[model samples]
Target: MSVANSVSEISPRPSIEGIVEITRADMDRVNALILSMAGSNVELIPQIAEHLISSGGKRLRPMLTLASARAFDYSGEGHVKLAASVEFLHTATLLHDDVVDESALRRGRTTARMIWGNQASVLVGDYLLGQAFKMMVEVGSMRALAILSNASAVIAEGEVWQLSAAKKMSTEESDYMAVIEAKTAALFAAAAEVGPVIAEAGEPAIAAMRRYGMALGLAFQLVDDVLDYGGSADALGKNVGDDFREGKITLPVILAHRHADAAEQQFWREAMEGGSNDDEALARAMELMARHGALDETKHRARAFGAQALEALDALADTPVRSALADVVDFCIDRIN
Candidate 1:
């Protein structure tokens, strides 16, 4: 049963908090399961895991899993397990990300790698992946396991690809898009798809969920990119210009580079590629992005993807859950607005 065509008929967006409220009970279960599964007799293992897990964030990925299962009317406990697995996968990635990025902060607090050291962070991440796979196995769903495992591999490839392409002036918009699709969107698609698969929802439903998540994830990351240039530190939970400091080749940089003249291009090359990214340089970069309307264009692209996500939601029944999910698309894009 596909409702893709009815997407245009759904009007108004709900609040993100409302959507979260709808899944609160299920999320509580997922949280408890996460805590239980993260435990190990190894002291540092649990310590690191607990540090990252207990830190404050929206927990959007696992919530997506739970809400997706609810949208499909799944009544079994399998969705709970899958939601925990999704969170474990997400947490593992964050641990590794901080190490790779040499990031000191995450979600307005010190990164696990910052306090615990890189080695402990990396090993704990591996432990979480081991636990994620175990939970997936416990679900008795081979297809769900395959989807998540494949996403995990693709995400790793995307990370390495981004590293190789970082701060390269020649990097195209398409190249960056492909990287985000894999690194950020693949797990989202898998997380949402697993819910319906566990529910034995048909192929069409699975496809719809995948599309919805893919588009939402794209919008989510694009907004994050925009926020890196424009958002306040309080809103971002990390310092503004983190992407600039890291020389990440995000969409804003790609757009600005395309519009820049030779001298402006030289500025980008020095600031981003040559690692001359001091505060003065970052200020100049922001000026360039504003001058070229890079931030506006990136937000426009994010809205386009947000619309795609909403359209994908039409494949499901026209229920409050679907409506709330649509609101999530709005909420993600609204971060930049």
Candidate 2:
């Protein structure tokens, strides 16, 4: 269905607040562990880490880890450590990503790279990775350790792939999907899968959590990509047209290019492929996307993935945790609305 149709069909549902409430008790513990683990005697390490961590971004990933454990009735201390590890891993990536993207703003504030410079950002990111692994080992689950470690490697590989593909308008939709799945979804899948593994749940439950996380991550990434072009800077916590300025080929660009006529294709080639980004240029590029329904179609794709995420939960028993998880899917997709 078209995104317009999908938007209208979706009933307003509970927001991420409900999920946070469900996981509140556990997440408080996770938050404490995150702060404790992020500490360092180096002073600069904690300084840089806290600069980003204190930002008002919702701790969605760690919450997912907590909620996943709760879903399986896993009442162990291991999930707490694992959840903090998940946050550190996520923070490390964001630090590196800002440097890679040369971003000035994140969560409506100056990025660490912008204030502390790229060298400090990169070093602190390494520090966070070290801490993340240390926490992982503390958990003492080889399976969980292996899952997150592999995800770390895959995330790096995805960043490299996207760097190579940057500004190449010829990039296909399949290629874009591959990049996101590796870079964004891999960690998410690991975060959810480790919960069930720690819980010693059966393979089916573990596999179901993995699938749910993967689909949710895909939906999340797609929505972020859509928002880069269409959302307000206030809403995005970063500048709009960032992908266009960076010449990053996202799904919106892919679908638009696929259907553009000769003249419109040439526009994309010059504006996006050539990285021509000014205010007027951004406006025109947005006009092209709207003219061709690229943004709408991207949102539709995200909603479809959100549906897949909800469907994956069917393998698990019904509970408030499950219901909250399902609502989280709706909340992710609702960002566009």
Candidate 3:
């Protein structure tokens, strides 16, 4: 059956405590390695890197690696390096994203780009990617290295693809999905898949982890897009309408645009092109979204992906790791509840 079509319902409110507690020991080592790898004599490199790395974000990508590996009873050290590499890849993307978005805050703190400058932020991000590749090479798994490296390329394409789609009313739902899958889900898939490969888990388990990660990534992005329109500044670590102001065509905006009539379409085009960017425009956007059921439909799709993520776990042994992975899905989607 199709994944989304097979989804039934979302689980209850979830907590990160399970995953964090389960992976505590491994995560400690991963954190140390991340810090060590981020070090550079340039002074500004480590300074900017540490500021964001320690900015209290969940570090969810690397945790996915740890959990997937531990679930398979991996006993070696490669998972640690792989986990840290996953984190480095994610952090590099964030630094680049902040620079591209001209963002002022991340996790409610001044962004690295804002604290240093776009030039510094971009360079430090490149430095992190270099560090990420170094960690992957140290792991000595060509398969894992290929997977993560491919994801790096794919994420770059996703960013460019999003720019192409930006501010264009012609953007489609498929275009938005493609962007999220490449930009967000690809890393999640890679982060999760590398764990099983390092553990030497069979093809079935490895494929299942990749599927799980991809679904989870899509779910995370969907919920994130919903938050852009409806969540609080404290919740988002930035303004609620940041996506709208940036002219990004997220799922909510895509759905709202897809369903609009002649005049409604004109309003959407105007707002998307930066002609309308005030509170009144934002309120009107919200009103149109509500009228078109855009937010509700977006949440529905997020729940479906969350369900797929939880379902993908059935391939693995039932244990704390599996339970925690399930909870992570809940953590991603239940916040919108």
Candidate 4:
């Protein structure tokens, strides 16, 4: 199906809100923990880390960690450490991603690599990863370490896989799903799962939270791909068509390419391989995607993943935390910037 047709087939869901309503104390504690954990001895390393860390981010991963713990009725302070750990891991990945993608802007600000150079970004990324592990050890839970270590490995593997798969016309939905699940969903799953584990919740509850995180992560990435094509530059914090220019085959383009005929396929091939930014070429590609309904199809997949994320919340009793988590799924989908 084409992107436009896929979008036309599904009714839009209601918007959810109130994702950032944690108590002042909880916010302060998490902030302090993140700041302390991000601190470093090497001046340049700390500077580079701050360039990205201090930049405004939604801090969604840490929020997931906190929300999961609260949903399980955890009243203890340990969630702070775990939340900080999750943020560290996330920041580390962003640093590396900017380097790998040669991204100049993130969150409407210059990326660390853009400001400090790739060498510094890479080293600081490594430092942040090391600090994350150290924080995990301080948590003194072998289980936490095991979970985060596995997540880190999966994230690394996903990054390598994505690099290897770049611009490959043969890339399929299954392959794309694997890469997103590994790179994006793994950390989210680990972040949510850690909360239940720390609270000593049973396997069923942990699994439910993991499902929620995984689905949410998938939804997040799918919508992100859509935004790359359709979002505004100011809203998205980067130029539209950046992904196409980078020659990365995200879900929408991949789906469209699949349905395209021989001539259309040749257009995609040249676009992916030729690095041409001619407006006429881009418009032609967009028109083909619209005609085939690939964009809409990709949106449907994103919505389905979001619905699954909400369903996972069924295991938890109604609470502000669960409501916020549900809201986050919608926010991921509808975010204009």
The superposed Cα distance between candidate 3 and the true structure at residue 208, in angstroms, equals: 0.2
Q: Model 3, 112-175: lDDT tens per residue?
A: 9887899999999999999999989999999999999999999999999988988887888988
lDDT to native, each model: 0.91, 0.90, 0.92, 0.84
lDDT of 4 by residue, 216-294 (tens): 9998888878877778777566777778878888888888988888988888888877676466777777788789887
The number of the candidate with the highest lDDT is: 3
Superior by TM-score: candidate 2 or candidate 4: 2
The stretch of ten residues in a row with the least summed lDDT in candidate 3 is: 4-13
What's every prediction's RMSD, in angstroms? 5.9, 4.1, 5.7, 5.6
Return the lDDT, model 1, position 261: 98
User: What is the Å distance of residue 100 in model 1 from its true position?
Assistant: 0.6
| Ranking of all predicted structures according to lDDT, beginning with the best and ending with the worst | 3, 1, 2, 4
Q: What residue pairs clash in candidate 2, if any at all?
A: none
Winner of 1 and 3 under lDDT: 3
Q: In candidate 2, what are the lDDT values of residues 254-291, reduced to their tens digit?
A: 98888899988898888777767778888887888898
Residue 270 CA error for candidate 4 (Å)?
0.7
